[model samples]
Target: MSKRFSKIAAGIMMMAILVAITFTPVKAQDDNQNADLWQVYETTFKSAKYVDLTHAFSPTIAVWPGFGNATFRATTAGADLPGYINEGETYTYADHGFIATAYELPTDQYGTQLDPPGHWNEYGATISDLPATYAIRPLVVVDVHEQVAADPGYHATVADIEAWEAEHGRIPEGSVVMIRSDWHKRWSEVERFNQKPFPGVSLPALQFLHLERNILFHGHEPLDTDTTPTLEGEYWLLHNNYAQAEGVANLDQVPEAGALVAIGFAKPEGGTGGYARYIAICPPDWPNGVSVVEVPGAPLPVQPYPLRRDENGVLRPTPPES
Candidate 1:
């Protein structure tokens, strides 16, 4: 009878403890900041036109001669699968469930790239060290193509930037400024593309952009900042812990203002350079690019022609219905 009484008391105590726990108050969270951002994506981003400001790099694309060409081939299985295949066999869709390509990239600097300060400064930030806040920013394009057409060795000056500001108001703080020289037109001519006498950004123009206006970074169509004897512009930027974009393309398609840039890059550990993709998000009325609502790619469309491996080991699309 005493043992039964003790068990009943213990059970009552446990019930009281549970009741206290159930009544404890938690702080009320009324903020819907995430929902607000979702609304922005649905309204502004979904309707915006996106232009690819990046170049598709290939084995034959213009690269610094010191770094060799990249190679592509079918990925081979390293070990035998119990029921699927043997060791040292190349995986193909017909045999393995899917096909994968193995890329032998020689250097991270071979393509349209984001060059971190560590590319030149030993103690500076690497590619992975870049912050998530760098994902998007206002885009500013300064047209210097006419100057470049007149002189291939043209380097943009502070006056040019001032002229742009006078006409289009001050460049926004933390915006990305691209010096458009129409230099990407020579991309198909490998030797000519990398040759000297290419358009570049002058040191003064770069200084005004970052130091005075406080821009996030500046980009140019050419691979280097300038063909100057010492590349002083690039040297100063990296030493001062700034990043810049190289080998950017399609600037003529994007507007000079009222646009934003979506910055994306590969974050290899301790990488000095990043293979970057820059996309310009234009206003809905822009005629150049497609909107997210137009090409909502949850399930991507099928190709008109099947891909076939070419003699160069790169895959090419076959002729349709032939």
Candidate 2:
């Protein structure tokens, strides 16, 4: 025995260097556990619970069609003044300076003498009096022209959102897929919610939710979400493709997918959609008592309210009394 075969070849070279230092730290801890399972599935679906589309801008809201001509008044007593307020009492700040007005319903007899009534056209062509920084985002009403008037041109596609993501599973990328169509309960008589022709989202469902599901936003429920005499008669699909960059019109109080939406844009610095105040955050684990005629299915015909059960049972949001 040549010294017992050199002590079994030095014990098989120290067990092959301890199996290469134990699989090099088990392949770097299996790639940090697959990047921590996609960071815990994007932090548990973005802390799940927030679904409010948006829609509330009163003065009998509802707009679109050269958009404008809604007013709110209360001015007199020293009327319209923008000076004298260093110490007040100039008729108590002109008797409570309350001047709210909007216009654009002009297009005939020389545009109604260039919009009379205390004279103030501010540029006047109307698209809802243009300047709220160009209405960039906030007006979420999400669908309701009497439930799409029996589906004439019936919008909402991408194979209806891939059949709602193969029956509710995918749709979670920044999520804001509102489309309620409750055309603001007929926006208080504006030729039946702005010159008829409601129902939205067509254009291959707005380029399949803005270029194949990158959806960070999208909105509907009248007030223009692209489907009027648009696309050629004035090209306006939220100002034609920023891919609905921050779109939202009047989502009649959102509820087609749970709820939680909060917009408050008054940015005004390069502006393009200012004056926003849209909130909706309900989630105590929702499902409280449930009533709104027992929300099962086939009753989402747009929503302007109808989902009762309060006495601590929860399921709130009830606004339909018109």
Candidate 3:
């Protein structure tokens, strides 16, 4: 075989092996026993690196202008509960021995989100209708940061996907493909982050990933899919009963291939959008994330200062000392 053909063949074989290792559960010695998955947890997962891809949402994070900012306040007692506290009284840690927060979220489309089809289509599946199989999938990160750097409004194209395949082989079926633009670095700077010319994914790229490769879904760093006059890319995705992720962060820390994405979301019944969390599980030697073995996490670390409500009503460490 030609050298190029031989290289391509090897790449394909490696991807197939990676897919098998990721999805297929190990068999147990005894068929009736439930130790198979336990073994996988003890062996594979324990040694893998984990990267958080979700951005924590708060009142300050940028949102679509149409959707107003969210509010956070201490949860108050209700009259009908028949408790010691009266209605409209705020609960406090000193008096009630516990404190709770109440969030006044204006929309489900806030922050990192999984946009279900129902967000646009009348007969499409809502957040709660998503299947359990959506829990985990192979992760593919197509880096377009250089293009985005040259052109802030750059939208990834089918050629980008083809180029990625040229190096990483075919994107796995049922995988979650994240378009990496490094736009998320601007997340803290709300105005700049939401400006007119942010990085995005083109409609053709989205179609290729879903129609040709059959990826579970495509995610991007920007909230919207493209900077087209009509946002046709996002419109086409949702109206066609396909879901996509937005406001995803930390793509630079993950590999181009050979990683798994753990998908999680708040399942509000019949909800149009999802408050989503995506975590990337990478190979142990990737060099940027914490491994399960590195941080067992059974007993989480405690902050030096106690949590107290801030001026914005969000809980923050008191005194703000480093």
Tens-place lDDT digits, model 2, residues 1-322:
2343243334323333443443567677565554443443343223333343334443344444454443433222344445533332233223443332222322211100111111112322322233333222222223334447676345665666675555444554545566665554555565666454655676776666656665645655454445556443113333333323122433543333434455444432333333344444322233332322344346556655765434432334687667
RMSD of each predicted structure: 15.7, 25.2, 4.2
Name the top TM-score candidate: 3
Query: Whole-model lDDT for model 2 versus the true structure?
Result: 0.41
Superposed Cα deviation of residue 262, candidate 1 (Å): 0.2
Model 1: clashing residue pairs? none
In order of appearance, the predictions have TM-scores of 0.87, 0.24, 0.90
* lDDT (tens digit, per residue) of candidate 3 on 154-252: 999999999999877798889999999999999999988888899989899999988999988999998898999998998999888899999999999
C-alpha lDDT (0 to 100) for residue 74 of candidate 3: 91
Ranking by TM-score: 3, 1, 2
Q: What is the lDDT for 118 in model 1?
A: 95
